[model samples]
Target: MSRLLSLSFFVLGALAQGTSPSYDYIIAGAGPAGIIVAERLAEAGVSVLLLERGNASTYASGGRSLVPWNITLTQYDVPGVRHYIKNSFADKSEYCTDTPGNAGCILGGGTMVNQLAYIPPQNVDFDDKWPVGWKWTDVASAAERVHSLNPGSTNPSADGVHYDQTSYNAFANFFSAQGYTSVDAISEPNSKHDVYSHAPYNVKNGLVAGPVMTYLPMAQAMSNFKLQLHTKVIRAVRNGSTVTGVEVEVDGQRQIISLNNGGRVILASGVFSTPRILFNSGIGPNEQLQIVAGSKATTNVTLPASSDWINLPVGQGIKDHIIVTLNFNTTESVDFLDTSYFIKPSSNITDPYSHGNGILTQGYQRFTFWTSNTTSDGSVRYFQGTCYASGQNYVSMKLYLTHGLTSSGALGITAAGNTVYTVDPYLNTAEDKYAIASFIDNLLVQTRKADSTLIYSGPSTDTGASLSKVYTGGSHWVATAKMGTDDGRVNNGTSVVDLNLKVYGTDNLFVVDASMHPDLPTGNLQATVQVAAEAAAVKILALPKQQSLSSSSSSSSSATSSISTSSSSTSQLSSVSTTSSTSAQLSSSASSTLVTLTTSASTSSTSSSTSSTSSTNTAQATNPTCPKSDGTTFTAKSGAVFLVECYVDRVGHDIAYVDVPTNRIADCVNKCDALPGCVDISMSGTACYMKGVVGEKIVNSKYIRGARRIS
Candidate 1:
């Protein structure tokens, strides 16, 4: 192994100086990417530090709560209460103030605030936009892992039946009559054209569930994982093209967090904030960095000199789904469910948890995927139709134009050091405008054919030109730090990260979030972002060991003195280091170990493993030592027999159900065994559905069937 002593001295000196804590890996932003990466790294026995700009979304803070059928849960946990994040009650501290965008800053990031729409990106979404080593095949296992950890459900209600289907029935009947195929969107995730499906959400038993309910908990359970909430990262402490640590402010106290020798820093702070941090660190376009350096607002901090800057395209090729809403008035007979009813507590506020049934459980939105044939180039531009109950006796149909749209924007920093979208990515291209017009016209025709009573609202007669004026981003921003083979810093290219998601000019710095997406997907981005993080974890684990730099001189120049040097002393003395004095003083507070690195990148294909604490760690039924039958028997505490394909219905009018939050099949069986007269149980995605009796035999591929012991 190539051991460079200079780097080790820098780390040791930082620790000796006593400025801030040190970690093997420091991940920015506690979003999907950050949580997943932290979990994986911790599982590998590597020390990880995850930083978030917002506080925890716990039930005690009224940010997340669940009261079942009676009253809605907190704004962060309930599906119906999600609109509060975008309304007047929106917490400014938890959102980005630079632009009109809505990027979550909380512990779970967007997962805590979004509508929980969960759908995998189509194969084409990856095959078209991503470069080599990041195609659909590369991320397929990651997608499966995410689904297995936080599976989406078409029937999220405890009763296994969809509730308040007035809007759904209207849209489904209309679309089905017009030759649209109806399928379970979660089961068939890639079927994106001429198909209508229930809104597949990442909600389990009435709560907004995803990384917040799964990955975050598992990572927190590990001793090596550390989290810092309500902390803001200013910039990276870098020397030339290398980053050694980060400068942060926690509770108004400035500190410098140093990395271990040959340590790495992962930036998963979404698109806007990720680029903003890089720009502040003098790692963006020369002109953009000049703007920051010349700004009076940035004068308080010692900005890097122009000679030390690592000029790259930090913020470019930004993209978002363009949205257009179509409103319709429902008939007197068609009863519309009031989604805003959850804004205030209901009369049944004290009702017991009903396993996610009632209005608060579901997102109350039905979706339709359609493909447009009006494009002259024949590119695969698609549209997403989200019909939801809104206003008084009205249903609003939102049409989101996505996939194959060529419009893009750019992000830059202002003189005040705030991030801004200098160029918005809404209908900026001729092709996208044509596609939107064609999609709207065709959608209007379909609606008329489906239900004549449904009236048209604004933009009824206008073409794509007029609609462009009212279009808004779908809040699915991506590609600011775009990843590709082309280097944006040279040859008029436009990619910031290389194929491995490493910044073009840096070795140890990586971006594993939506910011690295080369293009937007056909559906929601949370699933794909998790997939990217999963793949990144494996790629990072496979890299060769990083060589540390060592030197005898105690000066900033000594940090990168020479590449050829050997030092046997593990404890070397160095008074001076490459980073500032603040970094040296902060490093003494924490201790970290050097992580083992693979000698070479692994050439094996990636596969999903369910051994993590958040997943079901069950032995495969094919094991010869295990009992073999049509059902997979498990070791349950209450002597339960697990049948592979059985279910129960009609507890309370076939509605009342209980879901125990446990990943182990055996533990789930034990919960069912403990229940009185609980004859049947169905388990899937960290939830156990218990029943009073086996009313009828129902086959469901998604769930594992279990039965209680008669003895």
Candidate 2:
């Protein structure tokens, strides 16, 4: 009813304000963080004006709701004799080519149609990498706010389950047998420690229930808030410390998108888009302005004194998780591969989203990571998210360098236009590259250990092939609007926003999104970025008019008093009650041993928190183990179906299976019959991983690829 009435009101309002819709606050992009900030401010009784480049129906895909990738993919790029469809993340949204950098020109930014998985970085990360005056406590509060503001935005299965829990448990157990530990986590902001599982979604029943559905809706309801779609903000109207409003494009016509001088302005545009906005306004790295615009420094938008020229690093230390995965298929018998995850996955409904679950829900043809691996792990070293299409469901194992060093990427405007950014992400650092290579090696090794022949491998598909410069740079990009001690390189190190999140030279203007993260975390960037936005908002609202702008001013008396009003009071949308998963029935002796295995597991930094610790039921040491199926040990065999495998539970899980290393798809199905429990498979090369609970010993079976089960 509310949805319908809101629709009617919007129509009437559009008829009324079609000529000119005024607003108090204007935000740039409509991605996850951008939507969050807009919603937060609007709720506080402030008029918010959001300018979105895409149309509203962007989130709706007719009645089908199927993203573009959901339909086409299989039509092309498959393995074998012909028509091999191998569309990696390269064809997803952002459509970044070898050169042309395009930001999502649609509403909801990336969130309207991203994997939509939400996570929070570990406590230690905020405590260490983020700037002074910000810590785990501050961030935790923010995460809580975002989730509370938008809770359970996902679809649960027809049954009670959310994802493929059995498969996840099977593989997770295998890791435990190898002496790994499990982390016990919760979705609430209670600050508990646990290995996180399927994070709650903002998708309600096959819908992309993100900013467009939640924050944006609430903000739109307020008479104080106004949203304008199909509009692009060119730059902020500035006259020193004061932002008059914005210059925007509406109906392909340029117009002055005004905001009250007293009302604020926010750069909610994403990382790529935000910096461009700043640069166009003559507020970025000087060298960038000169090179891109061929300008001798033209626009005088009122910057502070020359001494205030912060020689701070901006858009440096860019990083992302590198991924590697394999797959397998046989017949029907738990064919949860193509669709249908755990109908009763043994996880909490309030679980925070992550990768290790038996099957992934948040990732459309994707998977989550953190994977209890390296600490100070690999980071975004100048890689961009390329696209094969706007959207698709694919599998990938994202890897993070818990720590990043020795390399940096700069986001500079190129003379070509705002569309082309100088993507000089240096990925050849010996240490960083090698570390990436090693991580890739670990992925192959881990997957293979679960099922020997689970991948498409050959002369073309080697461990080194996974390290192809063409492979990755996940969505997680960070350190652009960074913090820390002022560095003279990469422009000014003196951050754009201070500890309280207020812009250094200006008053009221604030940057409360992923751009403010000083250091990239070890894993996905969404959770951490959102948390930063949360914390920034808390501080922003607490700021007194006079106290916020002064860098030297201590906390204001009024502001402090306001802060004291209610430390526990927050304006979050709602709260999610986390239910602890019923503990596994371990033998008393096994439980005692398990305690030691889990408690002693170490935690790494530079990534989001969630330790799926590998624990051993040493006492029972009799963890469920798989018996090798192929009579013979897995060897690099020819003309045979090989399975590349990994342990999800104690049992083996195939990454992918294939028929011929000789490069032929002739006998794919017959190969599966030769191996036991080989349910289904996806062939890439000669590597073929079985799809069942294959044992600890990865089997390399010998069979031909002829026919597969169509059923």
Candidate 3:
């Protein structure tokens, strides 16, 4: 069939009745990550199939959840509509019913249903938990690609205005009084410690612009790309360790879609659904496989024989951010937005909604802040807080225990073919409970100290046990199929996927979504999922394609990719050019001007703690001829190619400092190259500082920073 006709069939949901179409790549789940992988692979001149269990969400994607007055826009188009959809519109169709927890089942997945917040992951998010080759330095450029493709705005109004600032104004003042530094978070992603910033929403021209609005259209425009909606992938069609295709259910009819020779299959069905797929495919733990094997009533589909089962820890290590809500009475006259505006668009041209410049353009949360607490065990755990106006005099703060938490849960598939949480991932550990309780207690004390007028009349004094009972998950689920150096098939190994994101003991069967995230990120997970998909695409494309399997292999040993060369494996994917520049570090025309303001609060009594800031004044380069602030590639005299940025100094992870007496930039690069663990360098005057990892980046014109590019 012609490409156009084929695409039309797929787009119109004209189910392929009996026959299976061959494709070079078949991706399960059309979430932000799935669509991104589909687009990237299609762009590489490969035939791709992207399957979505849910239908289109955005109006542009044929969504019809429109407000009465607006025929051109759907409910998903508006940013603030997220507040209403979760319990209303989303429950009927957008939310996954098969999973016990909340998860988006629409075309864009979480990005389509979420609050549209576009907070990117901090460097420590990857540096701390991710395995080698998936670190901040390796995936930084991939993150930048996602950021460039989907630009965000703190103020999303078409008129370049912040529509509802009452809540933001009040909270910004409150956080400032608590000694939190004000920052444009997108510009300074590393400023997670004791910092507050305007909430960044991913929208364009007053409409939701996520993977559905950005990458999906690009994929649809390509002849090689086909999107099949209303198609639920049951499981991978596994032949020994090789995944030949996927068995899916369309309109209650089961079908097996085969892959082309040497093709690949990627599971992006999300944290819960992906593991379910693995379990159904006989690739999970023995206990889960046994349940599936005997579940003739729940799962009608025939399962692979017990002898072919590949035991791996697919549903282990599930994690979600624990959220604690605190209500405060503010003296500031904060007006609670009329949520009716979301369901009914104003017909009057004079109204801001007509111009897409009203409160409807903003998300529920006006401002977001980050804080950290050192637990009694001497380990630091980070927490993120978002403030939103709950009522005229009432403001609600949601405190999320984000990265560095040591709590985990398990996921399991029931005999009834439903995915359920085997264990809750809340404050399961005493350390996590203590950390959250202490953090809240400290925050309450600070709030009282900062503004005595702010009345707290919500929950009573929260002890660790009480807080644990009251806390709900942030719904940022991740790490079901974790990526790590250790193979899950091996004894004492904890990872389901390897560094290349390929599932252990399976050839050409990979996971590219939150299911593979080793840990939860610092903020919302959509942006991080897209970045990971981008990085995974680059790695998957660079690897040599596997030949068609003629006969199934008898060996049940772990399947390892040839992508890694050594223990570090940073430069192993040399076939794919890797750059060090990150989305957080990009200086773009669309970049918002950072308005950093110092609060009037005295810091004399504040704790001398570690923050995500760099002291650039003490590390200034005295040489007057320092390179300009333009992002340029510089080659060292010793033949090391580095991506150099002037006026940029990396934060933390200082290896050592060497004095380049000649005060030359080349000398600094050479010095960094000579160091054993140096991956980047920051030079000021004659002092060259070598860094093992690129942490948070602070703007400083006095120094030149170079991140070695792996070509």
Candidate 4:
């Protein structure tokens, strides 16, 4: 068969397929991190496929509002209703199982169900837990971008007033009187040592707006961007250390999702699922793989041989804030509301959205972060407190022992493929125990001095045994797939990924979520996780492009030549001279004939030549019916068809396009094929353009024509 006919068959085969659709990048989750990275890459004109285990959040889709606000909203959009998504309606399919705490399985991941605390991590959080290249200074720019895009408002009501300031004012007074600096938490994000501030949330106009409202909309607007919901990624399909694609089950039907040439896969499936996916793919410690390998269900598909497994400590380094709650009665001056109001949204709920002076806009009215006395290791221990109305006329203070805790834990998979923390993170060390106890005692003393009218109703002494019973993971879990320079596969290192967030043994696989954190930060992790993803996108874009199998020298170049000929009809001249070996030459007389050329190690030259054929012969060989290109006539490939538009004057008509410095008609076609939704291409001088949409098709010779395969 002729090369033109072969090219035609390739196009038809691609369009006829229903199961496999390739993309340049495949992201496994649609959380804040995943959505941010996807948007950035898609903005840069790379095709992306984002898969989410849950459907779109009700907030974006406009679900029913229990309270009549004259505006459409869902539980996800309201700050007061946020707790209902996880606490009241949690057992619904949107939540994950086998984890000690709840993790959202929806499109926004944890952001969909989290309390929306938008505090950025302190500088010490990065400098202490992150790798060398991931220090605060290195990530400052990304941090700034995240904060700028989603700066949660302390007072989100339309009205300029704060809702129930009774609890907040009391705590502020107490903390301030105790010598702790009072500042805007978000404004002084780095100063978490001894500060009390009103809690900052991603809520805007009384709505829980986050990445779902920002990055996702931009990505969804791009033609080359696609999202598949309710798809569960089981494992990655790999050959040796290179991942070709992922195996996912959509609606109970299993399918293989392939990647385009030189493509990448980013795992942003949270701290638990990210590691579990790696383990299922046989990319974890040997002991864990052995457990997975023994399960028929897990090993039902292709399993890597023992020696072929990438043995990194994937499930190690698990950490979470240790939380302990204390209840206290507020003075007569302070008023409170109970959780019942959240269930039955009162008529006053609209106050925040309409006037910005209601209780619905805030989670916990006040929050505090402070340090305890230095520990034996010379590290300053940290603690966080948030005071909110727990019930009628009663306030609850949830204290989180955040920083300088040396206790680490482990996550393991069950026979059913559920991720669970085999070793919980708690006060495992004597120093950690002492820190928690002393910290609680000091807080009690301060509260007694600051507000003698208040009455305490919790444990007086922090007996290690009593505290252990009450202490649990703060639900701010992190560090399952740690990132560091140390290779976990050797030298007793425990890190799973490198500083670049790439899996230790793979080239194209990366972890861009909380799973890559070396340790937990001192504040809510949502902001830091987002900043890390932004930084990861920058690093991934800077890395050298991965070479595709077709780009190899061993592949036949005849198809490429045929595609090039159909798009640009230069002369069928003899061999072109080069710095190295010369490419095979075509006979001058072989005008309409198909020819095969052998691979050559030659540097491209900028020389041109034409065949000495008669005008009639030239016209016959190079069909004038084809799109005009620089006075050169070209023949359309037999099976390939394009919608040609000429004299088009519109600029920036395409949603996204790739620019090649040195134009090659064949290279441009290949690039378009690799990108999803690529419909047209144009070449002008040395500039080659790949466009998503073509506005007009005029009959001007100045424009080169291209078309998307429809058959």
Instruction: Say which candidate scores most in lDDT.
Output: 3
RMSD of each: 15.2, 22.6, 15.0, 17.6
Between prediction 1 and prediction 3, which has the larger TM-score?
3
Output the worst ten-in-a-row residue range by lDDT, candidate 2: 592-601
The candidate maximizing TM-score is 3
Stretches of candidate 4 off by over 4 Å are 1-20, 61-71, 298-301, 351-357, 447-451, 459-465, 549-711
Q: Decide which is better by TM-score, 3 or 4.
A: 3
Candidate lDDT (C-alpha), each: 0.63, 0.42, 0.70, 0.63
Alpha carbon lDDT of residue 530, candidate 2? 66
Instruction: State in Å the error of residue 159, model 3.
Output: 1.9
Error of 2 at 486 (Å): 2.9
Give the 10-residue window scoring lowest on summed lDDT in candidate 3. 561-570
| Per-candidate clash tally | 16, 121, 1, 6
lDDT of 4 by residue, 148-223 (tens): 4566777766566677777776666666766788777787876776788777776764556667655664455444
Per-model TM against the reference: 0.74, 0.59, 0.75, 0.73
Query: Model 1 scores what on Cα lDDT?
Result: 0.63
Report the Cα lDDT for candidate 4: 0.63
Per-residue lDDT tens digits for candidate 1, residues 269-290, read 8888899888888888887888
- Using TM-score as the yardstick, the better of models 2 and 3 is 3
Candidate 4: the clashing residue pairs are: 157-356, 158-356, 159-355, 159-356, 645-697, 646-698
Q: Candidate 2 at 340: error in angstroms?
A: 14
